[model samples]
Target: AALAGQRLDVAAEAASRARALAPNEPDVHFLSGKVALARGDLDSARGHQERALALDPAHSGAMNELGRIRLRRHDTAGAIRHFINAARTTPGEHIYSRNIDVVILRTLSRMIYVFVLVALLMLWVPAVMHVDRFPFAVGFGVLAAGAVASFGLVLLRLPREARGLVRRTLRTRRVATALFVAIGGVAVAFAAVAFVPPSELPQTLPIAILITIAARITATARLRSPVSKNQRPGDRMT
Candidate 1:
């Protein structure tokens, strides 16, 4: 009731009493987290949220609140992961599902930036390894087009409202995100030559598989890295 009224003092007081009465109750801790969030006490909010999750790992409510706390901390990846987990744990919630789609689309855009880098790296085979430059250019163009189409298709899977939300959310991270894209682009460009084929496009299927493995490994590392705090599972960095 106090929480609904936006009365932090009363909420905190009630939550404290509830905690004392039900020390191991996830809902009690979640209430405490809500009170802390109402007071703009992120540290306390995070603590309580973590406690709630610890007590009940499948607590979708706790996951949702924790995701918001992560957003407040500028931890976009963490927030997205939490939101995704909340959606997966409770598939009927439209809000969580919508949030996940927005984040996923934004993240896909970032990855497309990286893949462009990877493509530049992969282009070396036709440019240097292949004797004919025309076919190499054509095939490289195909790769670039494929990457772009893939990003577009992913967006098309989302509703128009979610696409708008993703665009708005991306505006905040424009500078930093662009910088990251450039850096990743450069790194993958360097790694590209290793995956390039020797003239024949269809002949490089095994190489394509290997390059896919490398991309997945790179993506996994980004997801698992501690570059951001308060992350839920399968959080993305790019």
Candidate 2:
């Protein structure tokens, strides 16, 4: 009941009692680990989760918690492994599936870092060739608009319940905010290109990085879709 209610203090007391009563019980260790996680003792949480996994090797919940802990510690690979294990061990568990998708997104983010570098290098062609400014501006605007459109598409797929919170965040000035940021990004790009020396000019890289980041941010925002071998579909709940 305590765990269900997310009353971690009460759950901790119950877990302590359970551990005393059944020292070898995997569930007790799992409960204790959950409590430690709630208290932000990641090391303790990880140890208890490992102990639970050792006792019950098929404990999907323990694997799920371990994955979350690994993510907290910035161990993306480990997190993905544990999350995959949990999802494979218990395919019906929503938490495991959701977490696996999230871990996959973290992995994709690393790939995007490389993409940013390459895309920036490609952008240099336009700068070096002295491409017509109007055409270059049009191309950049199209890319930016595409990124924004992707974000809007992703937003449409959000759960009905979550839309409220996201809408609240957008408020009534989102258009104004987007225009301000877009104009500012364009101004910065122009300034960098105009002021930086030809031999030393590396403005394309930064501009490419910014554009790629925006594109990938939209991709990240769409990550809940379960359209892959290891991915699970979003839950249909309020």
Candidate 3:
């Protein structure tokens, strides 16, 4: 272990010397970034890593380092996003896989919480209790069905592989997901209000709309993780 540490120290010094000789070399910047990260100089590490990535956008090392920095900062969502890009560019890397796994589990846990909340809310809402009392049950059910379909539509629109081409395609359709999610949420709110008594519709609709809008916004932001259809099993990074 001592020998290994010494070797790392020597390598770090060599990297510094290389940087001094060739300041614009992407590999030198990448190595210096790694050494700074090892020494816990996160800010300096980020500077070097970003410089390396700027010098060579295809540098998987720099991309992975930036992702690691985001992970350490507790920005799991951002970390996952960056790691996905790194993984796409370097599919054999185990580091990207490990980081991506952590983020995936975290995201799943949050999604479970949201699902549970939605289930509970559906059960307890007064409009749901007396379903037969509402004259608009048919319309409400239709709207909710549409909501479910909208979610599926978003999933369908996602690319089968997360590569340069897929990212470009997604960027082109950036507003589509947000728009669907927003409209679907509004539909759900109106459906929920349709169950209420006619007298309470005016009072309840606005509040329900606001709450639904907030929930939709949160869900849209949280679900921004990569969706790749052709990701190979045991690919290490994808």
* Candidate maximizing TM-score: 2
Candidate 2: give the clashing pairs.
Answer: none
How would the candidate models be sorted by TM-score, starting from the highest? 2, 1, 3
In the predicted model 3, the residue pairs found to clash are: 160-229
lDDT of 1 at 192: 46
lDDT tens per residue, model 3, 1-238: 2223756677667777889999999988987888787777889889999999989998988888887787678765566667778877888876675556545434333443454345336533445454443535554465456555644553344334323332333343323454455545655665567666657865785677575656555555534545455431121332
User: Which prediction has more favorable lDDT, 1 or 3?
Assistant: 1
Model 1, 1-238: lDDT tens digits are: 9888877788899999999999999999998998998899999999999999999999988898888898778666677678778877988876775556445544654665566556645645554555464554466567667766866775565455445545554453432354354435434543344345444454554454455545544553443344233322223321
> In model 1, how large is the Cα lDDT of residue 94?
60
For residue 91, what is the lDDT in candidate 2? 82
Native-to-model Cα distance after best TM-score fit, residue 13 in candidate 1, in Å = 0.6
> Per-residue error at 15 for model 3, in Å?
2.8
Q: Model-by-model lDDT, in order?
A: 0.64, 0.63, 0.60
Ranking by lDDT: 1, 2, 3
lDDT of model 2 at residue 93? 76
Candidate 2 has a TM-score of 0.52
